[model samples]
Target chain A: MTHEAGIPLGIRFKLLSDTPQDSAAQVVNEVVIGDYRDLDTLREFARGCDVITFDHEHVPTEHLRALEADGIPVRPGPDALVHAQDKGVMRARLDAIGVPCPRHRIVTDPQDVVRFAAEGDGFPVVLKTVRGGYDGKGVWVVESAEEAADPFRAGVPVLAEEKVDYVRELAANVVRSPHGQAVAYPVVESRQVNGVCDTVIAPAPGLDETLALQAEEMALRIAKELGVVGHLAVELFQTRDGRILVNELAMRPHNSGHWTQDGAITSQFANHVRAVLDLPLGDPRPRAEWTVMVNVLGGDYPDMYSAYLHCMARDPQLKIHMYGKDVKPGRKVGHVNTYGDDLDDVLERARHAAGYLRGTITE
Target chain B: MTHEAGIPLGIRFKLLSDTPQDSAAQVVNEVVIGDYRDLDTLREFARGCDVITFDHEHVPTEHLRALEADGIPVRPGPDALVHAQDKGVMRARLDAIGVPCPRHRIVTDPQDVVRFAAEGDGFPVVLKTVRGGYDGKGVWVVESAEEAADPFRAGVPVLAEEKVDYVRELAANVVRSPHGQAVAYPVVESRQVNGVCDTVIAPAPGLDETLALQAEEMALRIAKELGVVGHLAVELFQTRDGRILVNELAMRPHNSGHWTQDGAITSQFANHVRAVLDLPLGDPRPRAEWTVMVNVLGGDYPDMYSAYLHCMARDPQLKIHMYGKDVKPGRKVGHVNTYGDDLDDVLERARHAAGYLRGTITE
Candidate 1:
């Protein structure tokens, strides 16, 4: 958020856990974290805050219910959060709402998967551990019958999906306030590698205007249906048939909306603040005609600061952001945002900066 | 700067001075008053610096001369600063360069001024104290022959201008590096109250693009002629005859270019850092179609923070930059920069933020 504004744009952090004292020290005045296990601690922290929201849906349903009971305002309340937090619940709820989701089957053992895969509905079947799976973890692609054996005894509920070939991935982000006002940023196209986001291009180049509108409508429907308070990121798959399919959902600031940090009228962070605080939501229009954002994998550089400076001096428009973190390999350290009048111009800036951080000589 | 980008930007001050215990620790980093009195001390402190320039050009001319003498690199060297430092020299130089300037007669005595105003120019001549005047101070507008007595006896070197009829004042800021590369930001229409800049609108709405270009060209010519190092701000007047006249020159970062700090592709500070360091220049393009900057006067409010918060909440795009200072009437403590696709869009943002800071509301 700091790098996107090319200056410090304000985004206050609200930690729902007590383990972030060191991080709290970094921002002495702006943030207040609570001991999640202590209801009293959580209540005390939430009282004076302008808005009550979550980074993740880990807060107990009762705690959220209690906050709502006291009029303290738990954003996506327990009722809505349950649908987003549990994949099975989301599928059931979304299916009930007539939203298109991938065909899936729940199984407790390997025999059900074998029975499903041999029907030849697909060559490869995708197995997913429904809860607590992120990135590419907790997912498997099984080709034949023998390879799917471990899941029966893995002690995790398994969900199988038909492998569908799609054109690309798309994300539609909508910011909503308590007043029932919502604004949508441009649908962004994202590239994923090993289940981690690599880059996001705003406005989703080559996207049909009608389809884009449909995607936004879908995102807004889910946000309104679930009564999301801040931001909702609706991930979608753009199939070769020019259809968008529901992939997943995130109820807070998501990686897909990062491009808006620098490209749009109001960064997601600031807009999130506005929405949660019940301030008027800002225009979600893109400042530049086109913009792209790339996530920096920590393993890409030894000295992120020096490397970041090199990128900055080379292309002042390349807004590079480095999380104050120790770099390892393939960790999502931070990201860079770039914009221009054309997609090629903005995309080059994003790609080149990411390549520089990745030690590749990008064009 | 703290108030503008907000405290969230975290731009720390690094004070360089000599003497281990001088009174430099009040705000910024180590106020190491580097001994400019000695060459070794100067070089040691300046070593490995990204840019060696001035806060304001008050360094000994000989010191700059010596730096240039040793090929140590200096901008606007003694030669250029001399013109800015002396009123007589600037007038003479501007005249020699075939630029339009108000008719002027250098007067060392009171009787000489009265005689010149009476003979040809008539009544209502302006008297100015050369070299150290800013705001409305050190200047006098005389409507009659009897009004020149005080300055005539104060032993101040006074020069007189024809007081031409100017429709509006404008500023053209151009930056250049040692390699002779230069770029100019859009010309801005300036509004001044008591000779202190109150507001600036970028591209000067209704300004002729051709004429604005001509004004920019003239500023570039002066920058090249003066061998300006960092940035050169040219104060110009659009006369009734549709001709532009040069009024004043600033050799360092000037108030007029503050909008670029947030609205331009390359900020003036970042560009200055590049220029003084003799590095490759960044893009000087204006990202927004329109931008407005309003100076925040100190005395208008008892406290700036509350107003700042109000402004932030009202308009998230208002980039309020307050130079940490105590409030006093008519004092420039900070400025707010707002930009958008339309002139009115940004102008409204700038105006509301300023009005809030000034404790005034237009309903």
Candidate 2:
């Protein structure tokens, strides 16, 4: 998707792929196949690049610091990226900044987890590994000490947080340039299914205007506070009491902002490119009254082209985006976006197209 | 641009680029570096490809026929493509179909060109080669027999056309599927400078509604009559008396439709991809009330990045699209699109950004 956004800017991409069949590798012309974890490989890959950025935050912090020492410009440099790479660091930083967050503390063992949970909301606490986690992996909700043993079994440092009763999930997407210029897209409601993002609606229909502005401000402040560059997706929880808490932070374009591709004046991916390159940011205003995005998860059927045809025929206004990945059950292979005056109509249209493309709906 | 559109659709492009530095070759991963005119190269490139399409109409007609004989689905098949490749065939066909066209005839020599001009609006007749011409090449506007001798020197059949005293140039862009599904974009005013397209304004501000509809209908009819599958751009000369005359025909996406990339609901390139792939076509409606596109021709400055940064900072809403081509004097390397409710604002913004990007305008 970043490659797609870069094309019109006349930007050339030199990608480092783990395999030739990787989704991005299928499209990018200049690709070096190597393990990103290897310092030597990272050095070789960064040789001719003007600025280095990422789609994933898995590159080791030490390697990024090394690259910076070697005079390579690494966006969202290791100091800022570590907040996203480690939950403990993120929680500590947010606490220091007085940003609203779930009550959290580092726990050493199952007994420590019990103590941490008791200090907060008690039992049913969320325990997350400080590193190497995504899409709901490396996190657990335990009701008791016995149930908490599972999170400590991995032997990695864990952070326990009070599980707040939230009304729904929202995302505040913002882009920040190295020069500090920034823009925030409207807050959006995000729905998750089986730990993966399923749908997103821009402006978060029926959201309080004040709360939306607050979320936007909080996201912008987070970007500045962390010295982050590029896209900052603040996954948020809107509590039943009307307070919003930061749930997670991502330093790259996130799934929740995909609707901007067809809905906003500037897409998140495009703005991310602009931000990382330190070019002026484009407008983040919505182009339509309502925009809905639904993910097309891979399912029982692998032949999606026929379904894609059906969806296109069904809705001429539908914008379908597919990642060139071989279909695998439950994997996000594509998404559909629809926008119009009526939110219900747009939502239904997007949902139908995504379902059809995923082969979940026949007619 | 086609490659950029194909990315979101997950279409894998196999480009047959004449050089490694060809604009499309720079982005597309699967590229075969070879001369497209070579029959063996074309055949080898076509193998395993689901269909064959083109960015240019220069591929030999006979070679396309051979490919069709080999059972490859060639869009805008040789028969339909020949009209775009040969001006004489195009003029004759449009005349037979009762489509309005500039007065033209095949001229044997300079003396015949003079004779042909006498029958029409007299001197200042335009001369065009029957084959191999684009962007003002292989074309001449002669005031007398002596000036007409240059076109005959090419040895190819020359087409003599009366230079219509046009009030303005307009373009009707349409896309047609092999299954006959077709959609016409709103007619746009095309402004030319030194015979090259300089700017395009969608919905042709102040255009007569009836004439705009007539032009669109004419383009749609021409697409059907020619059996064109994919985009067909009918360049028109809106006469001083309000009649629209066919200026030229392009079987693939044309420069006049570049505004659709950021101005329309579905871009011409994306629709062309859908049409060629036999997929359902997308909507061809303009997204804004007024949209303007200005071509950024290469100029004295070869370092465009600094100029690009300046333009982006100047107008946050301006959308710039570069073709990834090396800068060369008077060559089209990129374009800028600006759209909004006010036509004048849109036009000025686009022109200024384009001029700035071309290094022709400072401050």
Best by TM-score: 2
Candidate 1 lDDT, tens digit per residue, B1-363?
A: 221221222222344544433222222222456656576666666554444565455466667676666566666677887766666678888888887787787876666777778766676788887756666666788876567766666566788887878999999998888878787888999999878998898879899989999999999998887778778889998999899998888887788888887678776666665566555556777878888899888655567666765786687566656554567877776788888788777787898888778777533
A23-96: candidate 2 lDDT, tens digit per residue? 89999989999999999999999998999999998999999999999999999889999999999999999999
- Which 10-residue window in model 1 chain A sums to the lowest lDDT? A2-11
Most lDDT-accurate candidate = 2
Candidate 2, B15-44: lDDT as tens digits: 999999988999998889999899999999
| Per-model DockQ | 0.12, 0.89
* Residue-level lDDT tens digits of model 1 in A265-348: 677866776677666666688888888989877655567555555776688566655554457788776788888887887787
**iRMS values for every prediction:** 6.7, 0.8
Residue B312 error, candidate 2, Å: 0.3
Q: What is the interface RMSD of candidate 1, in Å?
A: 6.7
DockQ of model 1 vs. true complex: 0.12
